[model samples]
Target: MNLRQIEIFQAVFAAGTASKAAVLLNLSQPAVSKAVQDLERSIGFALFDRSTGRMVPTAEGELFHREVEQTFAGLSRLRSSAARIRDFGSGEIRLASLSALSTNIVPKAIAAFRQRHPQVAITFQTQMSSTIRDLVAAGQFDIGLTSDEVDATGVTVEPFAIYRAAIALPEGHPLCAKPVLSPPDLHGEAFVALAPEDRTRQKLETVLAAAGAVPRIVLETPYSTTVCAMVQAGIGCGLINPLNAEPFLGRGLTWRPFEPALYFCTLLLTPPGRRGSRIAEDARTLLMSFAGERPALPADLHHVPEG
Candidate 1:
């Protein structure tokens, strides 16, 4: 019999009378009686004893009800699962981000997301921008935060942020005197370079070359966090996304604006045709909230008061 028929039988059985079942089901008494009669005909057995003036369950009907109870138990579980998926997402969110954002902003966004949806599980990975693009395009990751340099051939792309590259330096460094710096200021200075393939690095190098500003290269790294650490360690100075410098600001590292502005463009990547699960999309919204919200730093970052 159909679930509607089974539902009618269940209501009639629970309520103990056709009139009561009609009140419970929001149907008329005659309709409820007809539905119970239809169920008995479909199953080829009477569910209620007709000899009694009041409704009473038959022995066979009681045995059949045990199975109906089990069926509804499973249906209850399905309803709960659907509720979770609709409200908190499909249980998990998988996200990958480039090191530039992963160092500071992405982690903050994730923390906020968790506070809002504590039940949603998150899989967060820090990879190169190109790798993030690849993962998103292949449908291996639900969302990707990457630099605009990655080829968008396989995934849908949108601008997430564009942080102006800043000059990261050790405290008390001489270059700190300038409110804003340009390629000429770094000439012959010790420089910690980003990896050769970095999109921002390529642009900065082009500007440095055109201006004949050749800083003495000290070390090379792919991560902006590492660049900040090296500058803190007195290894050298470098141009990095200021978002990566926030955690290091109080730890002996500082940053200043760079002129002829070089920007670290950030992109949001997702599978082209379809969107990600509810939790993943929720995380994407949180991440976008961090855009352009950098804390204001003092202009004379390197001029720490003698303490």
Candidate 2:
């Protein structure tokens, strides 16, 4: 009915019980129950099937809750926009990033951005490639960084950084003694394949197939950080983007560049047709300036016109 009632209804829908909602909302169970009843009465329908001291959303209630969620999301964005207007330099920028880039590349970019706009609040979430793309496209995030190339229908993607792929080998692995490793060097060796959907794995596979090599895969993981850990334990060697592999250099692991070069570009994705807030625009500029010196850019970016 009202914003307060809508908020209470959402909490009840989420918590599934008046008592639990009460605890979450810091209200008494009766108060929570009263709020939900008031909302259902205002809507001229029962919002829940109340039988066993538990709340189960009615079919209409479920639909109503989904709408409420969307409404609240829009309200939150509006609130953020208003706060930005009150203080242009200080506002929240929500971002989602693939796990590999989240650890280093994204953090480094955020660090550089914060140096200039110290008042801007940044919230970063690390997720798998698909999820990051989805969140950004859904307006849940202002920006997304990922190694994967996304074909999101309403999102604009721009290359932000390039990471050369490297192979991480256990100290005793045969490739450890080699200064450089070619695809042939990895031939028949046991490997830790990243998830089949991972951009890094696909690139590595392309290079391997080109070099007439089919590796013996021994492990697979979604997280590059976990793959690094697996390599440290001698579980198997892995091919990783340098951004994720660089920090694991000396912990019983050795890294060598793949002979047939493999690399992935880090892309910054934003919802289409939506300009970033001023602070976000400034942050993007900072990111571009810092990322320009990284591997992904062509040699001529120094002279290229700015976007």
Candidate 3:
């Protein structure tokens, strides 16, 4: 009739006597017998053979017992799954990232995070920085990686790491021979630029404007990877984050520290009104660890020995 009644019936059936069931269930014998009787009455049949001195199940009782066994088994599994989630031993983590970081920083951090949280389901999406901020604020993403700090209405932002932006040039470009470049050195070169609204675009524009050097803007792309590829193709030279520029440095492209070293700082963004999400915090820790005390060079970066 109810879980309590079912439990009492199970105890009585297992113990083979109402007196023994009452002792096992910590209830009086009368209470156990009443519960069993109530269950049988609700089901419209006798569940046991009363004439036998030993408790024996009727055909109907055996059929009911089969269902009760299955029901209790399912309840046991449900509690176990709930416990696992509550303990943070298993769950899904959704992440979002700016296009630049999606290809470089995220993969490494995810690799490290997976080693520890192998059971956590992880999903990733890539979008522009502004989109990342909006989604994270709306609780669509547990964690977001962005190049610039995001200050949306319902999101918390934390500084993760900073890496210098450098000039990327074709291997044969004359500026590659310069030991240290100033804005004047890059003047008049055809440029491959990020979208005008991109954070790094504003920073680089300011640096170039201050030096009175206007680049010949020929190509524009939103992703850092595309800018680096164009630079490698000799389409134009541009300033880009080392993490994005380093990988293509030696493949017919050279990276040199920009004169007024424009540094790019990565920000960790999370939904507000939550103290901390296990997934977001884990992502933050993983990114910071990959960032390390020192900045990361692009994957193909090589430190040339000093002259």
Candidate 4:
């Protein structure tokens, strides 16, 4: 009938007598008997036969008890899971990030977060920086990692990491001789350029144009990983974020500091009005910590202002 009736019925069935059920449920025997009577009346069935002052369950009562037991078991499990989630942050954390960060930085942060909260689940998605920002603002994701080029109208943005651009070159390349490369040094050199639509690519183009230097553009793609791959294959040298360049090291790829530094800045994005779950906040902290541990670039390198 109702949850209370079902609970009393279950207690009576388990304990075999009204007085014993009352003791188990911390209720009076009269209250337990009245609840069971009301449940039988609501169900229009004789749940138990009273004989010799002992209650014996009818066939219908046994069948109903089976279903009630199953339902109660499910409720018990739900309560346990809810408690676990509330106390230990053991639930799904939805994370969205740019394609570049999804490769190395985000994964490293996830690994660190998992070490502390092994039961917490994670969902990671990769999209353009704008898309990541939009999804986070829409509350579709708990956290977002993107470049500073996003529109921060409906989202809260914090500086997550600052990476200086580096020159990625194939081993034995002539530019490898230079400890730090400037735009003029790369002039006329075959270059693997980022897609024109990329914000970082536009900034880099502006910097090179101001320096009166132009590289012989060989290929263009949207992904930083592809740029690293092309450089390793000797297609051309590339200026890329250091985080993207880290994994390609010692794989026929080497990185040199780029002069007149152009920073590739990443921002942490969250919904403007809502606080994130404990798990999401912990993950954000881990990501920031990982970024901080990366080798610091030169302090004297000139910073390119955000346009």
The backbone clash count of each candidate, in order, is 0, 1, 0, 0
The digit string of per-residue lDDT tens for model 2 on 1-307 reads: 7899999999989999999999999999999999988888888999999987789999999899889989999998889768776766447788888787667667778888778667577898998767788888888888887765556567888887776777778876877666667888878888888888777688788888988988889888887788878888888888876556556666676666666667666788887788677777776776677665433322211331221
Instruction: Give the total clashing residue pairs for model 3.
Output: 0
Count clashing residue pairs in model 1.
0
- lDDT values, one for every candidate: 0.85, 0.77, 0.79, 0.83
- Candidate 4, residues 92-137, lDDT tens digits: the string is 7889988778877788889888898877778989988889888999
- Give a tens-digit lDDT track for model 1, residues 1-307: 7898889889988989988888998999889888888888989988899677767999989998999999999999889778879886587788999888876778889999989888677898999888888888888888999887789998999999887788998988998777678899999999999999889999999999999999999999988889989999999899888878887886788888888888888899998898577787888889999876864575455432211
Candidate number achieving the greatest lDDT relative to the actual structure: 1
TM per candidate? 0.72, 0.64, 0.74, 0.83
Per-residue lDDT over 96-172 for candidate 3, one digit per residue giving the tens place of the 0 to 100 score: 98877777778999998889778677989998888889998988888888867455567888887777677777887
Better of 1 and 3 by TM-score: 3
lDDT ranking from best candidate downward: 1, 4, 3, 2
- Winner of 2 and 4 under lDDT: 4
Q: Point out where model 1 deviates above 4 Å.
A: 1-78, 87-89, 302-307
In model 2, pairs of residues that clash are: 162-296
Q: Choose the strongest candidate by TM-score.
A: 4
The global Cα lDDT (0 to 1) of model 4 is: 0.83
